[model samples]
Target chain A: MNDHDVIDNLAESDDCLFCSDHIEEAALGILEAEDQERFEHHLSGCSICRAELARLDTAVQLLPFAVNQIEPDAALKLRLHERFLQERDAEPTRIPSPRKSESRIRGRKAPSRPMWTFGSVFAGFCVALAVIGLWNLLPSNESSTSMSGRNFQVYAMQSSDDQSGGHIGADPDSKDGTMMAWNLDPSEKHEIWCVDHEDNRWKVDDLVVADSGSAMQTVTFPKEISTYKQIYVMRNDGTQELSVAPNQAINGDEPAPSESTPAGD
Target chain B: MQSLAEGHPEAMDLLYDRYHRPVFSFALRMMGDRDQAEELLQEVYLRAWRRASRFTDARGSLISWLLSITHNMAIDEIRKQQRRPQKQQAEDQTELMISLRADGISMDTHAILTERRELVRKAMDQLPQPQREVLELAYFNGLTQREISELLDTPLGTIKTRMRLALRKMQESVELQSLEAT
Candidate 1:
């Protein structure tokens, strides 16, 4: 730091080097490592900087909330869900407890205390990515049991004039699923509905088709899949895309003949 | 959280559904590329899932915890990319502030979060340009205060002063906002 750097504001008194400005730097994660270590040591006795650190930490936490919310692709959700299930199957009963360390530079008052083994967590995460890459390289039959019955096709309704269609991935036993469509008109609002036997419909989600003639979003099904009779995608003017049963075959933009229709609930 | 720790998929499903937007949005903001952001998003949830048993009520709210994870990961990613010789980062503090100032605030955002976001923008808007720029340089751009000093051609003391002032003003604004709400 330059000589003039000492002129920056301190908490209440200028006697302490561990001042409010220094703590703010720590909160911002810009404090040099040696200074951060010194600041941590100083926090043991200085209540003024400690209080300042806690208060500044709250404001630091708020900044992330100010970011613009851009929804990720629907397929990413499917990938995450599959990864989660695979993680569960691999380690069925153990959730690893973090090894405690003051490794990160957040304030002492931070409750969760970001207790990650950054190197190990990051290395393990990379290994997981490699596994995902390998899974992609394998043919369908090689990984059929794990990924079977996972892809769902959302076709265009016959009355619709557009050629828009989508594919949603939903694990058979899991309630979480995501849907996405392509060739959609960017100007239109489209909603996905999960319909039951008596024609009761639950609006799973609605997405504004994106500018690239494609869109995707998470679907929050109201009930379990076996309880739903058909899923439909409808446009704003009450135009329907396609109504599909959970267990039936839906070809690309066309409704195929069902060889094994699910029993109506 | 209990079910999550006890190895329940439904619990993981619930946590992901409730908070993934904020997590995903923050990751995308930091990474900028769609694929990179999505990859970061998946890694974050996977980490949380593996460590669910460690999450306790004392660890703070789930939202804060999740955001903290995102922040740490983004920092690592940014620093990693910074070390690469082939590519230079394109977005700077000015562009970041403009994007944040844009009219893309979604109507569907949760009410409490939306309120906090608006209040933060107002607080940020009230700062002098120099202080605001310094704050973003450190907070968002991940530039060390020393680096910011070099980048802006200012004294290190002056950059420190700006960062302190910016954060102090923001804290007061947030405290006042909560008081007004109550």
Candidate 2:
């Protein structure tokens, strides 16, 4: 074959181990002597082929390098295995909760409270508050109260329908304490609340709305009222209100009630 | 493997034992952050559990597949973070230079070869930028030349030439270093 024909033929041959297709196996030194000789001949004349052969040789030499074994850390492996087991034991079809996933990403230590700790504490507080007739004592208008070293300000507004309305609670102790202002738009059935943290919870307290006219109701609790550690604001109409605390707010901007607010008598 | 797929706890532990270090090492090398590597290692295994069926021996060994996944994930992470300073990027270059300068003959060639830790890295630095990336994909990442060509949108010939040149350069570098030592 002519030089061009020879080169082209060599390039096209499946058996030409220098070709990129067979370079991997050739580099691994699996090529037969005839194939290796032809590849070496191509390497001697063609700079491109030469460079490739040299690289393959280097890579072969480096194969032993790649063999360096890395011992996995025992502690880290244990931790990963533990997490894997936890995930395996979890419901296979269940989607991971975004909050839990976020915590995992953030490496957040487990909260000191148990799963039911806050719920139970808040539940007990709600049952007692409801049973003691404290809800009745809250005025139909805006009110502010301080209890158990925590401050609370409540605001009540009249729905446009002049029917059941929503209230926004500003609890400074709440995570991301911000003034939460939620008022029932009489035109719509959906309840709305906005939270902010500034000048105590008075802004939110002033904005709380109830079905009872625009009467500004105020309920002050004594500083000595220490029994109530948790605060719950319930809609008098009996619809569940979205409760937010310093820890529960989206951004931890909710404000607590000022200590000066009197306790409910 | 069936147990792992079936959500058996012990299978998860065995899988972890099998893959953690290599995954962590890959992450650390790619991202250069111990904590981030640790976190990424955890995420990788978690993802493996969630997507175990994607793996099969028909394609390659489990370790090779896992390494490929880890490398890709780590590269994605590195791309997401701001690039480290050019100076830091050249740190390996500086290290090779320092070692070469400090010990001309007395240095143990076997030690250098065995370490292979920085030889490939320094050779990589010596390459033109595009060639370096191509080599990185083919060797470090185990991507096929075609995959690399597609990744860089370069011609197949170009990828082949780059790999060829990179490997030649690396060979020359190691040989030269050894010769100089002797």
Return the top candidate by lDDT: 1
Q: Model-by-model lDDT, in order?
A: 0.61, 0.45
Q: Write the per-residue lDDT of candidate 2 for residues A1-265, one digit (tens) a residue.
A: 5323433455643434345544643453333334544554344335655455444564444432342233334577677767776765552232112233345535644343322332343354345434333543455333333222234433232333222232323343222122222222211122222223321121123224322111112223222212223223333222223333323333333344344433322
lDDT of 2 by residue, B1-182 (tens): 65665677677666665445445555655555566667778877776665464456865456555655565566555545734212222333333222222212223533543356556555556779887776655544345566677878889888777766666666667677656667
Q: After superposition, how far is residue B26 of candidate 1 from its true place, in Å?
A: 1.3
Highest DockQ: which candidate? Answer: 1
lDDT of 1: 0.61
List where candidate 2 sits over 4 angstroms from the true fold.
A1-74, A89-91, A94-265, B84-164, B167-182
* Tens-digit lDDT track of model 1 for A74-99: 67667877888886666422211122
Candidate 1 docking category? acceptable
TM-score of each: 0.53, 0.33
Over the stretch B1-182, how does candidate 1's per-residue lDDT look in tens digits?
A: 76875567787777776677778877776676667778888878876765565565664677777887777777677787883111212332233332222333334336656777788888888889999998877776677888889989999999978887888888888888878889
